[model samples]
Target: MKPPDGPDFSARWAALRNIPPFLRMVWQASPALTLAMIALRLARAMVPVAMLWLAKLIIDEVVVLSQSGGPATLAGWWDSGLADTLLVLVALELALAVAQDLLGRAVSYTDALLQEKLVIDISIRLMDHAAGLDLASFEDASFQDRLDRARRQTMGRIPLLGQVMQQMQDVLTVASFAVGLILYNPWLVALLALALIPSLMGEMHFNARTYALNHARAADRRERDYLRMIAATAETAKEVKIFGLSPWLRDRYLTLARRFYEENRAIQRRQLTVMAALTALGTLAYYAAFLWIIARTLTGTLTIGDLTFLSGSFLRLRGLMEGLLSGFSRMAGEAMYLDDLFDFFTARPRIASPERPLPVPQPIRQGFRFEGVGFRYPGREAWAIRGMDLELGAGETVALVGENGAGKTTIVKLLARLYDPDEGRITLDGRDLRDYDLDQLRATVGVIFQDFVRYAVTAAENIAIGRIEERDDRPRIVTAAERALADQVIAKLPQGYDQMVGKRFARGLDLSGGEWQKLAIARAYMRDAQLLVLDEPTAALDARAEYEIFQRFRDLTQGRTALLISHRFSSVRMADRIIVLENGRVQDQGSHAELLSRPGRYRELFELQAQGYR
Candidate 1:
């Protein structure tokens, strides 16, 4: 599956303006709630502006009262009627202040709730799409980067959108002040508009550069994070010390961090230089206005009270300029980041599962056949398995033996339908494999690969994951554990079947490598499939454990077609038929006694392993 090539950010940003579905969702989910929240925020903001204006009114009223014609005493200023006006303003101010606090908490809580909902929605959708994609798509580095960016941004998108509301309210405050200025002098209103330019440009330039660093260093960041985990994680600590790999992984992490720091330093330098220019522009305008305002008062055209009001309003206007400038740039950058998230959210898998899937009949009568099959890995020149002709009949036990890097696993993957064969076909009961439902085909084949997943879950849950839709039968889970000879391992644990099998969690018990391998085997046994494939499934088991597993393997595979791959001849010898694979083709195949009689690749491997036992 091909990933989207080279994101056109400009095109994507333009597309964000057409926020039909996303905005519609917010509206539909809680239109009244959203509007109520916005109204509360706007009401909260007006309180601050009113408080600032009321301050001036109080000062002006005091001046007028001081100049009144009637004979006045100190007692008059403290009179009940005069005190009541002051008290009402103070009371209103306190009420508005509490309203501000309440609104802050409410909006923060609502934003968090919405942001979580959005992340879950995006994560689930991405997981669904990721599931639909063929395994080959994960090979693309660009695809992984897209996934990472989408996930991170989705977590924070709503908070950023909420802040955009903050910027709008601030802008409205600036407009209200400017409209007041318009009554006094239209020239002051125009100057207020002109003041926002320098800061906006500076802010936009800095944020874009910061995001560029984040984009360029995505892989290195993840590597550094993994290195940290390995250094700190409990299970890895012992191995890390034994291998003397801590210093190496730490050095690798430091290298990535140093590179990130250098990029960050460069960005800081650029930001500081831009900010200096912006600061100089604001200083020039502010000083020139200060001198002009002083001259107006000295020449008797402007009263001290008028200057006081203008000065206070201009101070508010200046804060608004800074707020709007920074806020708008932040919003634009966040919107661009959101575009990346939205792009990924909307990424349809390159492979669309057919809406009407063809049926794969159960009981798998004759078994699967690989006919003239061939496969080459992605971005590779040579074939991993070329023209591989293989077959397995129902109720047959077939063993595949091969040297390292031989095509045995590749053939297994093809049979599992993890990858589509480049040429020719695999058939089930003489019907083309593609004609069968993908899920149904997988459900019919139970596979345990060489590198099986050691899920960090409870022992019961781990075994039950082999066939998750089976309702996690504890009795069946216990039976599978006994058949794989994992009973002793589970019994020693603190919580038995309920015990978590990874050191990542608190109170979780760790397992030996052999123990994990047995658990993996038991997990595979939970699947009631027509075919069972085990690839190097007991590499961690001791000689005795290996012998016992093969003794039980016959019982586990009774009446089912089974395929196994193993290096140990003690286990391989039990197979009814053995097939040895070389570089990309079959070298020799027969019963163990017959293959031993032939003195071929299989015989040489058997002797080599038997020598190791000595």
Candidate 2:
């Protein structure tokens, strides 16, 4: 695959602008913890400069005491106390060391807590945003890449908060040390600034390159993650073992991973070389300043205390400058990654309810009518369904029959407003479906597709997802399950309603395909929707189960609208009417008996199916 293009310089700068908002989000995660962290950092920030100044004092005091003929023995020194200034300085240094250790621990503790809260906040927001997106967005590969990058930011960029806080603390310490150096000789400050300029620019350049590389490789990273999941997860374990796919999957993973490694290695190699050269230049400037300080002391132009303070400050200033510069680059890179997160959050769902949505007509009087509807999936040439006109009346049972990919499921999708028709409108009671409140619309139309998710939760909770607020209503759950014929299956479980239904969790009771299908069908009944749809959800059921379920489907869906999509003519024959679809257009429509007597696609298909029994 071709490598994706990297973000331009303008894009990188735009990403940087997201920092303030990102920091605001972090702070908002936990106000008290965030405040505590800031306060602790401020205190810790001044400690380094204070400790260095105190060291200078203690060194000078020792020299003065020795020259003044202080007590020789330890006991005499303690008793006479002539070395009191030295003793006091020594004690103060020890106290400063102890204070620094305590403040450091507090800052770390606060940071860890803040990180935890921020992760939770980001994860929740990510899930909520993803939930609001249109189904089409999830189907788009580019959107998936963006989502993958956004997901990584929740946990991967966590240390960014601490890094920024530390950078702030270091800035203050550098300023404090710089002031002391300036009082001695301002030229030294200038020399130190000049030395770090090269290194700072180098770091920024390399950081930008790294961000570009990561941005370009988003799709590749997503593929690698998918491959890894397929190789390791229980969901694919059966097929993987039967086909002996382990080696092939491993090799494919290695090929993709190695490509990423090679790209990253090239960037790292250049960064290493540039950083080394810059470090040598900084070291040269440091020693040059060191010699000048010694020359000033030798010529009687400076005292020992002044020399010690200036040299110590100069040494510290260089290290701090280097740290501050390097830290700024790392922070910029992290902020760039936040672009993905903020971008995902800011994405507007195209299928959202209108601002002034019309209330969904209760009892759905006129039912749903598709008027010359046409739809094409994104990036596709052929329409999934086109020029289709159909009506599903209230209290009617309609079966949509067709070959695979004959737009059977697409019609169901359009009815549920999962995807609006591209070329025409679908209206309910003479009002466009788009005018109805989206949530209310979905709630009124319950659909169970062939590929319905088999949740790994408890049996009761799984069915309860249909009407989540009524999950605690045991009577309602039991009623729905009984209607779907899943009650008998669940009643035999070791824990019954409380039993976990998938193999994902420990001690979970795995059910057969038919049993799982029955459980899924219950969710639709649980909804008690005005319009209930089953799109081949019972294909896994045995012949007897399928026949029995459809025989009672009308009573199960009494006084409501129903649309069933199935290839089994035996099941299709139970509907009040059957519509045959071919090549994204309806070919025929009638009762099963009427269709059997006609010379058309429906008659052809019905006869073909009947031949299997003969």
Q: Which candidate is the best by lDDT?
A: 2
For residues 1-614, could you state the per-residue lDDT of candidate 2 as single tens digits?
A: 33334455456556668778878998789989988988998899888888888888987787787787877888898899777778888888899899999999999899998999999999999999899989989999999999999999999889888888899899889999989988888988898888888887787777777777788888978888889999988889999999999999999999999988887788778779999999898899999999999999999898787788888888989999989988887787788888888888888888879999988888888899889999999889899999999899988999999999899999988888888899989999999999999999999999999999999999998899889999999899999899999999999999989999899889788898888888898999999999999999989986668878776777789789998888888777888999899989988899999999979988888789889888
Estimate the TM-score for candidate 2.
Answer: 0.96
Model 2 stretches with alpha carbons more than 4 Å out: 1-14, 73-81
Candidate 2 collision pairs: none
Error of 2 at 195 (Å): 1.2
> Which predicted model would earn the best TM-score?
2
lDDT of each: 0.75, 0.87
Q: For model 1, what is the error of residue 325's alpha carbon versus the real structure, in angstroms, after optimal superposition?
A: 1.5
Positional deviation of 534 in candidate 2, in angstroms?
0.4
- Model 2 scores a C-alpha lDDT of 0.87
Candidate 2, position 342, lDDT: 86
